[model samples]
Target: MELAVDAKPTYEVGARKWLITITVITCAIMELIDTSIVNVAIRQISGNLGATVEETAWVITAYAISNIVIIPLTGFLGDVFGRKNYFTASVILFTVASFMCGFSGSIWTLVAWRFVQGIGGGALLATAQTVLVETFPPEELDKANGIFGAGIVMGPTLGPVLGGYLTDNYSWSWIFYVNIPVGIIAAILSWKFIKGGKKKLSGKIDYWGILALIAGVGSLQMVLEEGERKDWFSSNFIIFFFILAITGIILFIVRELTTKNPVIDLRVLRNRNVAVGSALRFAFGIAIYCSVFLYPVFVQSFLGWNATRTGLLILPSAFLTGMLMGVNGALIKKGISPRILLIFGFGMVITFAYILYRLATPAAGEWEFLWPQLVRGLGFGFIFVPAASLTLAGLKGKDIGQASGLSNMLQLLGGSVGIAALNTYITRRIAAHHADLMSNLSLYSQTSNERMQGIMLQLQANGKTGEQARQMAMGIMNGSLSTQSSILAYSEGFMMIGIICAIILPLVFLAKIKKGEIADIGGAH
Candidate 1:
């Protein structure tokens, strides 16, 4: 995937540069926000569309499968079509799909449109990063990265907040509807401000490689997104896809490496920094996304908090991450070792997970999460800027697109795997804890008998017959047991994330890049 380079280039200056920055970052954030915004609106959407909650989940699954499928292909797409033209078309495509999604009369229709939207959204993210990289000179590359990193951090954080407000006040459709105006403006700005890449593919298109990528990544994403819901390998549907995922991935690796003109250049992983950096990003995705995924659900389901309130509680942490993006970027530009920053960052992530594990009780409130969330923000800020810098630091020109595409794809895949694994773990833990608690509460236990008696007496005093009181007492005991089991399971889940981060933290030492090398790309001042 070699792209031709110009002998001399012109850079956007003054207000023009800032305008381009805002345009690309806003588009990037918009695409990312769509990734999780629908989560909070699932129930409402199901009700409105006359579909079961289980059926409605395909709305999310479809988008994720298509998004990951297209991400690594963006470099090839951009090389064939001009970057600016491809970007504008993607914005327009996303806008149209969102509109169609809002008006869909059936769940499957919405899912179909969402798949289209994911293709566009995936293109927007990878292309936007490449544009930002080329927008500023190497010396100011950190600034461009800081801005893009801020969007990446803040987009998912803000998704639920905006989705909750719109869903609670208006309707579920409004969540998709809100993107129309933003998309229109972004599309116009993209075409006007972004530069065109003149490079075109000189060899035959690798159609076989493209199909293998779709089969491999799309099936794997489906397996991750739907495996637990479908009972994992117990379900024949999941078993088939799991096998396909493995087979397709193996075929893809072989096809890409052996093909003369591969859709995605697998050879870039030969670079040590790029390889280690991609691994770090994969772990970072798990850490960042698992926390975001679990916290709101825990608060809303167990603590009786509303979606909006939970999202609001997370706002401070999101802002802290955004602020830290610039700080970390500047620190890296000033020759601070990325390895040191990475170690400190992973340590904070471990600390955040442990603190949350300790606090994962039914009684924990908003205040308990405040300090820990700030620590998580620090973890994200530190990890993101330096990880991105280190990943692309060793590459220039065509390699930049290839490495960034692969890096982003790995991160998203990591999130998918983390969410699935944690979900399954929590389910199994809940069952185990429930069985242990039940065994101790048998009729032979004096403590269980006394507790049941006390509950029956209380029910009798509240105007229940003897038999009724006994039944009510039994129900109350079971309810308490179930709730306790859930809390314990969630606590274990948090610790699992911490352990994963700790295991991967050692990889930072393996990523070697000189100070200021990230800023020294293409020899531009």
Candidate 2:
């Protein structure tokens, strides 16, 4: 596989480049923030719109689906049109879509606007990374990545917090409205400062490949997102989509491998670094997303904290992650190997998972989670910068864009899978735990009888007749069954995440990077 390096007459790292980088990063962060920000406001939107909780959830799913579908094709689109033109257009589109989303009166209308916003948002993510890399010289790539990584990590972390605050103090529409000004600024800056790359478009676009990719990724994401709610394969919709997803993905792989000019160059995977990096990126996605998804639910449902409180809990950890990103960037600039850092990061995440598994109880407090979450944040920072740096290090000019798109796609898909699988695991475990708890109850057991009697007396005192009290006591026991079941489910969920990290640990050795590979890679940065 011959690597194509499209090196233009290099320009100095002047004010223009920095300005462009900032603009691109800002756009990327805005898009990513919206992805999770709506999560906190789902209840408000549902109540106001008179939609069911399940229907309002489409607001999230629509954006995610459109995002997944468009990300892999960003490189192609950027090449077809000039990068600057494409990027500027995307900003305008995203901004307009945001307005529509905010003004939407019905669930489907909001969903439609979100989907459009996602289409524009997806382009920004990969293009922003490429813009940053090209703006910096090879030597300063680590620092550039550090800056980019900060935005990536901070966006998701801040989303819920910002959304919670906005939803509480102002209206939910403001979440979408907030993007208008940011998008306008980014668009103007990008038009002024970002340079266009020179890539000639072929005669015809790979429409088949685009369709295949959309079908494959879109269907797969839908299955992952809605599988648990719809009972996986049990629902007809899920089953049909599952088959479509599998078929589309298989066809996409075949089509990309065979097409003369592929929509997304799958051939880039021939580069060992890109391949391993993409895989590790998938794992990174799983870890980051699972923690984000589980933490809020754990705090809100089990610990009885409100959304705002849960959002605040993650603030310190986000700061830690931002701090560590800077530190890791400097370390990479020095002669430190990412392999060592990644090992430590993996261990830290496992430790964090174990902490949660052990400390998790029905009554676990916020204080109990503070230190562990901080450790996890540090671990995430350690992995994200190095993993990203190492992944794209060997790729040349056009390959850089392709590799970025692929890695981003895997990360998104991994998150979807992680959330779906964890939800399913929690649901199943809850049932099993409830069964075990119920089986332990017996009339002959003194403690069980005493507990039942206390419940019966309490019901009677609450104005229940003797017969009603007896029935109410049984209902109380059943309710405790659910309470204990939930606790056990959360505990097992944490353990499952730990086991997953452990399973992936050995793959680090398979990365084929030597002790000093960081310097070799860093030199290209």
* Per-prediction backbone clash count: 0, 2
lDDT for 434 in candidate 1 is 98
lDDT digits (tens) for residues 1-525 of candidate 1:
444565555667899898898998998899889988999999999999999988999999999999999999987887678788899999999999999999999999999999999999999888888888878877777777788888988888899999989998999999999999999999999999998754755688999899988998999999999998899999999989988999899999999899888898899899998999899999988987788899888888899988898889888988998998899888988899889888998899899999999998988988898888899998888888888888888576678888889998998898899999999999999999999999978899999999999999999999999999999999999999999999899988888888999999888889887866863344210
Work out how many backbone clashes candidate 2 has: 2
Query: Which regions of candidate 1 are displaced past 4 Å?
Result: 519-525
What is the C-alpha lDDT profile of model 2 across 150-245, one tens digit per residue? 788778888888898899899999999999999989989898887765466655677888899999899999999889878888899999999999
Give model 2's TM-score versus the native structure: 0.95
Backbone clash pairs for candidate 2 read 138-525, 141-525
The global C-alpha lDDT for each of the candidates, from Candidate 1 onward, is: 0.88, 0.83
For model 2 the local lDDT of residue 316 reads 92
TM-score of each: 0.98, 0.95
